[model samples]
Target: MDTLNCIECFVRSAEAGSFAAAARRLGLTPAAVGKNVARLEAGLQVRLFQRSTRSLSLTEAGEHFLREAGGGLDILQVAMANLASRQGQPAGVLKVSMGVAFGRLYILPLLKEFLARYPDVQPDWRFDNRPVDLIAEGYDAAIGGGFELPPGVVARALAPAHRVLLASPNYLAARGVPQKPEDLSGHDGILIRSPQTGRIRSAMLRSGDGRETPLDLRARILLDDPEAACDVALMDFGIILVAMPHALPYLADGRLIRVLPDWYVDTGVISIHFAAQKQLPQKTRLFIDFVVEQFRLQGLDRRFSAR
Candidate 1:
């Protein structure tokens, strides 16, 4: 009557096509496997298999159950593996997928410290603007900016990020800084379209009286890459709305000035995501902890400030 044992018996029977074959795989007696299957069917109040003296086949309901049950078993196995491996020394190649600009600005630098701590760990990093299937592509982890975790993956936030309105000093000097969000309607604005989602995003500004409004700028150029949009803004082409992390260095150097500082939008969280498994591997766990600490030390929480 053990639920796990019942699942094991059911999965093996489905794959082996017979209780006897399943019993062999499970190291249980054929009669035991048969009894477990019957007990499971009785508990669920549904017949899981059609059996005759010569042959065995799954019922339609059993077929559906098997599909769902098999996945659960796989997760159980993965969890066990992760827990067993946790206490051991982390080694081997760790595959990481991440967004290009953020990875370059944030994650890549942290890798040096991680590698120094775990000399045996080697990293395989892929940076792209587009999203990749972590399970399908066989990546151990991914750092990305988004609230929505892809299905079948577990995510943990590493840092917070916000979208802010930014413009070059020269452009602001020429066009004159907008005292209010509505004033953006008279200015040239650069829009950033996400390559992965193809969604356009702009910054909203708030006034001293707590009135919030969206800036309506003439879209002089539209680009999918945020860094490229920053480049365009640097050339004094138009105002750019970008994540604070991406614009930090430029803003600090006076090349770009943050505008509409009172208003901000959470672009997305920078997070580490992996397959939702019960047991995370030692290497993956170490990296996750390391990145979280790194972000904290970098003062990620205070990266944005109202001007």
Candidate 2:
């Protein structure tokens, strides 16, 4: 058995906690992955995993080996990719994860140009709203926000994740527009319930001069997704507080209007995240630069801001 292949399988299985999950990532069958892992354990004469019908956990030896080998594996892979880039055009599957609405609105448009520029690089983009385990799930990169920066991952800011209050013209006309934060008492709010916290999202809208106003509105509809909240707001159901990336299209089309232009919720930044490697794969490097340059050319960073 190829020792490198066996080690790769072992590492992936340890990270994913199952052969099946590792197989999916490696583009191999579960049996192949398990066999590779078994081969590795046999050669070392040690049990690496505590395997059961439902679960797979790493043994003490496996845990220690992962700690020692994981970083080395990343470095080795990057080195190999770097050397491979010299032979020909950078070619491989570039798997990325991003929010559905944001990716479609921004990143998807760049696909045609990106392919035109680097035809050999195959794009395997996953549109997901939930936070993903980037390395464990085998994503080459991810674009979104609110991710905890783990040891080997890095994030590059693309835009401010500033959230703004929005209302449809029809809704505002009937329900009366709120001139001030305090005036939002009787208005119906399409509020987001945090998937991580299971609590309704709350905010203090801040202005340019550092003035803060508490956002206290009636939560008539609860939602987990921002795009869905935007859709509900478009139906004239109620006002919604959503990230500007989600609101920009509606705002441009006049379907939705910023309720209080000066004030917005300062959530954080929308970023493109990838692994922190000494040398990244050519495709990953190119993709990251392309996205960042596009954001710059589009002035998305400033546009997404609440100002």
Candidate 3:
């Protein structure tokens, strides 16, 4: 079998966790899938899978190989897409996942323009607050806050972002504004938790004099959605810390007030990430470039400039 075919088979099999599942996805027989994986293992002279009667797991060597090979595949796909764009129209499906609030506020509006420009391309979007495994889920790309990239993926920064402390004007008036980071402990706080990890996001507050204050407050309301948290803050429930972009419009409209402006909080990066695979279809590359350009044009980083 060809090297590209073998590599494709390996990735699919690994992601599916079984030869039968991978074969079903590829429309090939289970035996054919097994043959491809065997050929790939022989070429590399390593045992890639630990096979039991009913399950298959990656060996350590396979894990390492996937990381390196996946990146090469992404590069190859980018190159092919670039060439295809010059020849004709961009075509294929691009599957993307993102956070609910960010997607609804930003990406959804931009989709109209993107589709208008590349009518031949199709987009499949999934919006949720949960973190997804890009390769295992078979997504073409995903947009999210920057973190350490997982194995077998490549990440590109789309924009810079920061966490901001905010509360509604009514809330601040009733409870008083926090003059310092430590003051937050005395105020009612609406905490946002990650559904996938079940962990509350926390950050260190840095004063102008380089003093750092760690905040570990009990939330008056513990919730997972930022939009809901914002609503609670607006209704005078408590103060909330959220991404600056999501809070900017409210801040500008006098619905929300920024607190402790001099303190620096830990920032999150907005980025697009994709699997490292070879011979990427044209649609995915164009979509990524489009997103980056849109963020640039909108000056996404400026949302947190006041901080």
Which is the leading candidate under TM-score? 2
Candidates 2 and 3 compared by TM-score, better number: 2
- Please, what are the lDDT tens digits per residue for candidate 3 over residues 241-307? 8877678778878888888888656566778988766555678777888999988889875664435
How high a TM-score does candidate 1 get?
0.71
- Report per-prediction Cα RMSD to one decimal: 9.3, 1.8, 4.4
lDDT of 2 by residue, 79-98 (tens): 78767663566778899999
Per-candidate TM-scores read 0.71, 0.93, 0.78
Off by over 4 Å in 3: 1-10, 19-54, 58-87, 207-211, 277-279, 304-306
Candidate 3 has which clashing residue pairs, if any?
70-276, 73-277, 73-278, 74-276, 74-277, 77-279, 77-280
148 in model 1: Cα distance from truth in Å?
Answer: 1.4
Lowest lDDT block of 10, candidate 1: 80-89
lDDT of 3 at 32: 96
All candidates' lDDT scores? 0.79, 0.89, 0.80
After TM-score superposition, what is the CA distance of residue 27 in candidate 1 from its true location, in Å?
32
Q: List the candidates ranked by TM-score, beginning with the highest.
A: 2, 3, 1
Pairs of colliding residues, candidate 1: 79-279
* Candidate 1 lDDT: 0.79
